[model samples]
Target: MATPTITLVTAVPNPATFGQSVTLTATVIPLGAGTPTGTVTFTITGGPILTGTLSGGTTSVVASGLSAGVHPVVATYSGDNNFLSSTGSTVIAVVHASTTTSVVSTPDPSTLGAPVTFTATVTPVAPGAGAPTGTMTFVIGGSGGGLFTQPVTAGVATLTLSTLGIGTHPVVAIYSGDASFLPSSGTDTHTVIPAS
Candidate 1:
């Protein structure tokens, strides 16, 4: 007769940020003597199915690229000839990652009507991994000034202009948060002098 077995599941960093990898471990314990030998199948709701080979009665799998939401995970132990099958479950919560934006203008002090390029770089805060995706809104010269939007490519957005009135312009770059990243903003100052 096959011996009864118990399975238990646990997740490291239960509350993880989007794009962060999560480790899932399944432990199989035999009700009777001896360790259970076999494999474990992990099923993640809204994610992917992973299979792991049991080692010393425990097996682990790494999961990444999870969207921001609650995911239910189930671990099924594929019992050996001497052990009966068992199952365990756990929950993982993924939240949006925070980001920081920094803006820079080339040719800080330039002549009026000269092309000036403004660049914005967006980076994820600590504990968050991967590049952020979304659009960037450039607000030039405070309120009522020129407003331009650009798509972010590899965590960067840029805009070029040469029509600013001669003076000091306060430029702000606003990042439009995506499903995996939170919104952020940065500022820069550009001075335009009469064509020299």
Candidate 2:
């Protein structure tokens, strides 16, 4: 009897987002010349046990609805008459997807050169998942469009602009995203009027 070596192959985007589907393929190779034909069982830590039939010494399965964290996966080969069983393991890191980000500018209609405060509020798709921690990129539109990065605190980021020209300015705030959340953005318009 020959020894069967099992290899596990994980799909791309290993640091997958929550609710995303991840595929795992296993290949069985026999030490001897004959091919290994049998069933492969896959087990995920804190997840489920799946089985796949090997055709040409290979089989695969998809995993979904995984929480945000590192998941340990193992593939075991059921040896046939000519081969001995073996197992391989790998780890997958899953993250959360951005839900929504809303931006609002105070003093929407204000005098030119007056300080205007912009606030960004970010919300995660899954409340129990975790809080989002990152920076927010603020981009202003118009003749005097400018951009700057502000660190988020408790899912909120703030920026103040005082050199805005007298016109309609479009403002946008983008969340740079962190390990648990994906990037997200929001937009709002600020109007500056001539000072009397």
- Per-residue lDDT tens digits for candidate 1, residues 1-196, read 9999999999889899887899999999999998898999999998999999998999999998889999999999999999999999999999999999999999989788889999999999877878888999999993225999999988999999988888889999999999888999999998888886
Total colliding residue pairs, candidate 2: 0
Predicted candidate 1, C-alpha RMSD: 1.7
Clashing pairs in 1: none
- Go through the candidates in order and give the C-alpha RMSD of each one to the true structure: 1.7, 7.6
The per-model lDDT (C-alpha) reads 0.92, 0.82
Q: Which has the greatest TM-score?
A: 1
Per-model TM values vs. the true structure: 0.94, 0.55
Candidate 1 has a TM-score of 0.94
Distance from true position, residue 94, model 2, in Å? 3.9
Q: On a 0 to 100 scale, what is the lDDT of residue 5 in model 1?
A: 93
